[model samples]
Target: MGNVQLSLALSGYDHTRDLVEGRVATPGIDLVAIQLSIEEIFYRVAKFRDFDVAEFSFAKYVAMKDQDVNDITAIPVFPSRAFRQSSIYIRAGSPLRSPEDLREKRVGVPEWAQTASVWTRSWLHHEVGVRIQEIDWVQAGVSSPGRQEKVPLKIPVGVNYSSAPDRSLTEMLLDGTLDAVLSAHPPEPFKRGTGEIVQLFGDGGREEEAAYYQTTGLYPLMHVVTIKQDVLDAHPWVAGNLLAAFDRSKQNSLDRLADLNASRFPVPWLRDHLKDVERLFGGDPFPYGVEANRATVGKFLQFSYEQGVAARQLEVDDLFAPQTLSAYTL
Candidate 1:
């Protein structure tokens, strides 16, 4: 039988580079990789089901699943994972001193149901004793003037979320209109090293590392690879094939990063940094499959339900294609 051809939309990350470059092949499928920004990929896939397979937001995916939008099903391949402690930004000289200080303050976010924002909110509510209803939430782009929530959200009662289509989060934060901004992408002013805005966790790297060690044992997930349900129905083998290929691609990337003889990245002390990461997250930090990520997935589902992004609490098994949930041993 001829190989099935499929279109895949994903970000240009090192882990996915092998799949994009044809170094790793899906068993009997011909993949057409279309690299795009995370926002574009998520928006297109969530709204239009544009690609046969795509990297999608975990929060949005759960929200869709909760709403019974089952056009797409996911594999256990997570393309993006991050610790979101650093995502929280506060203006300089603000009265707010800690995560607990966010109570009753205006906080802007790129989207109400963004994966990064979800994790950040979870950290605040769970670790810092700040409830969602206590913060006045604003939704807007981090850099640009207008950005809208792509998915419908059943916002919890007493959660004041407003849209500022005319203003960016950066502008609002700088002008004291917003006390904080929770976003995956740092606001433009913050990225430029302007003293106007700073991360709420002053020593973000150290704080994030400590938070990971103290709370959840793994870094929080941001995106997962999803296959169109129709594609899986027509080609049941595609699920296993895609999962295997993604696993191989990620291993290849990890191998490159762990090569100490030659520096894979241009950053100074990359080898040492890699050692630190390995020490913290183990040899295979970014693991795939439901069994490997159960804790993180379970916590995220709990957060989504609590935050009203997911109408009902979901299990990890329910989120992934059944065939991709487990693999047979040789």
Candidate 2:
């Protein structure tokens, strides 16, 4: 029989580029990789199940899984990993000097259940000594108006959350209506290097490094690759096949980046930065599979449960396809 055909939706990340470009192939399956923006992929996949396989928010996926919804299952292929220490933004000279200053202040988020916001809140609660209930939370789009929460949230008691469909978080922060904003994407003004907005953690690279040293040695997982449950049920072997292909694709990307003879990226000292990453995170900074990412996965589950995003704490096995829990050794 010919290979099974499946549609895969994902972001245009360097690690996923090889798969999209056909440098990597999924055995026993023909992957139709469609590159998309993070917002489009997550919204379509989570809300509508639009693709056979897609990248998903770690927080939203766990929340859906906890709700007993079985529309999809994920592999351990994390296409995106980012440290959220730099995600918190504030007015250029707001009184909010530290994460602690956010308590009892109005802080806006694109969505309460946003994966980056979840990690930011986890840091504030555990590291910065600010409980979520202490803040008056506002939800809105980062730059544009009228963005809504993609998943139903079980907001903990005493937490005040209001939706501002008419105003964007950037506008609110600029107008002094919001003390700060925790967003996955920077506000438009900030992206353009406008001095009006600035990151909460000044010197983001240094702070993120310190945060990494304090907690798990992870940049934090933002998105994971998921397969529709019906697709998995019909072609059970597709799970492992996709996992192996993704792992290989990521490795190929890394090999390309590590080649010193020619710079793979536009940045000067790209090779040196790569070496530093390898020194800090080892050979495969972004390893796939449940075991390789156990600490990060476990920590995120803990944060999700503690923050009331997930109905209950989900185990690694509970979230990933069983076949992807372990890899066959040589």
Candidate 3:
């Protein structure tokens, strides 16, 4: 038999490697690596025609809307360490101290085309009373369609960091090139730096909003992995098997929570945040049992309609393959 093909999109999270490694150890699985941001996930879902299984972050789902794909079985939302809550970082020396203080201020963001940006901007408008149109937006990252692709509209005032290494933005934040940096959540290193958070862009306030976004009319966060429908049909069991393995791996990671805390990633400071590291174990990381997946599907469909991202309202029941929900729930 040939290898079991599996593709995953990732945020460069620490637990992501653990999940992929578990799949590789399985009897029949060939994991394909695609490092993607949440914005890219939407494009891949819209354009790609081949993929067996896709792992996604909750934010990515919120951005793309799950109904964009028809054969998703069970999508488990993993806790991204960076996106635990909404917060914006500004240089310690900057005069602006609140979200309301950011009128026409040049703000740095990884991707303006993403749902997190939308959610963040929405919060700034409704909660903070900051008009998004007035904010000088800086879009960072390589391959950002907003700037690099250049649609008819002028690109937002932002630097595309797709070409720069991951750590470059942190440097920019420190040097004062960026007035404030907005991410899903600031990494521990960013927090350790002299930068101060201006405002958390959500209704629940800083402490409670992260969990609230997961359940409310909030869109799924950006996730990177996806495969085309044809590949899944050809593979038959690959999609289900991968989700099962990831669910097992997620469980294993939680059971050995201490080990995960000690495990290292590219960033040492990120690994040192024990309290944050331990948070993934707090709730059902794999919240999408059949019912939850259905609920997410409904939410994504509603998001698409309300956001004008999609033309037709797709049913959550028809989105994933038959029995995918039942089989992957556990």
Candidate 4:
């Protein structure tokens, strides 16, 4: 047959130069634009979680893991505050001070959120000894179809609020309608979006306030990629090419970020944030070249299994396109 057309998808923040180059077996190749929202792609891919598919994360690949997948690179990194630096927001002048004060109180959250809401709930219920079931959950933006179907786990007795959740959450918090709001960062509605609200505490409980509730450990917010093995088997060249191309692009992007930042994407918070993106690329600029792929895959697979997502333990080799690695040696 003629050259195969492979499809790839990523978040808006991600740079795609490497991905496109990695997949190009020759100067010219077939095309299949599979562009979609990251959430939409993830939701679609999650449907096939039951299948025995092979997958690799460009982020994990570039970070220098032990194993090899196919071509993938320039993986995206979000604002750290959106993931690690999470917090609970209450009225500025309210008596509800810490996570402990939120017990049995109504809490507002972005409706049907997968990672942020799920992590927050799991942290509160499992780690903090808080009976999250007892608290009232106001799911904001329930009417938005995109947001509605994205629920990771069921909301235990949450009220599906349809109005603009940002406004609702802020109003509720201020008017005492909501006892708390669990969000990656404080809601922006209060300040008219100029500045974000400050976090109450760091990842765990406050060092000084020993009485407050906290988490047992830091949880991963997002990092999973899956691809079908059938496609790779059909087109052996695609996988390796994609991986190598992505590695080069990630390296180039990292090195030239300062130059690219001013014109392409200007933001003080985002500047130099991707210095660690190379960590995933490992020693070489190609995916699966070094042992970094194996290390990352092993770690995340174990994490996924522990999180009760995967049914059984999958060996590192079981998830990657092995043929792709041989091509990388050249």
**lDDT: which candidate is best?**
1
Tens digits of per-residue lDDT, candidate 2, 176-293, equal: 9999999999999889997899988778646565556456676688999899999989898899988888888888888888788887887888887877777777667788888888
Which regions in candidate 2 have their CA more than 4 angstroms from the true location? none
Give the lDDT ranking, best first: 1, 2, 3, 4
TM-score of each: 0.96, 0.96, 0.58, 0.53
Q: How well does candidate 1 match the true structure in TM-score terms?
A: 0.96
Clashes of each: 0, 0, 22, 24
Q: For candidate 3, write residues 1-330 as lDDT tens digits.
A: 888666666545445567665542544677776666644554555456233455543333433443354444434433342332356766555776556777767676665444455456655655556756666665554212232311112232342223233434445665676666666645345456533433334342445464555435343444433445666667656656555655566666545444554543344555345456346335443444346545645654554433333445656654444435565224
Candidate 4 residue-wise lDDT, 8-107, digit = tens: 5554433445444443232324434455554455555544332222222222332223223233322222111123324566665666656666677777
lDDT value, residue 116 of candidate 1: 94
After best superposition, candidate 1 residue 241: deviation in angstroms?
0.7
Give lDDT per model, in order: 0.89, 0.87, 0.50, 0.45
TM-score of candidate 4 against the unseen true structure: 0.53
Q: Which digits, one per residue and each the tens of the lDDT, describe model 1 over residues 245-295? A: 999999999899878788788878777778887877776779999999999
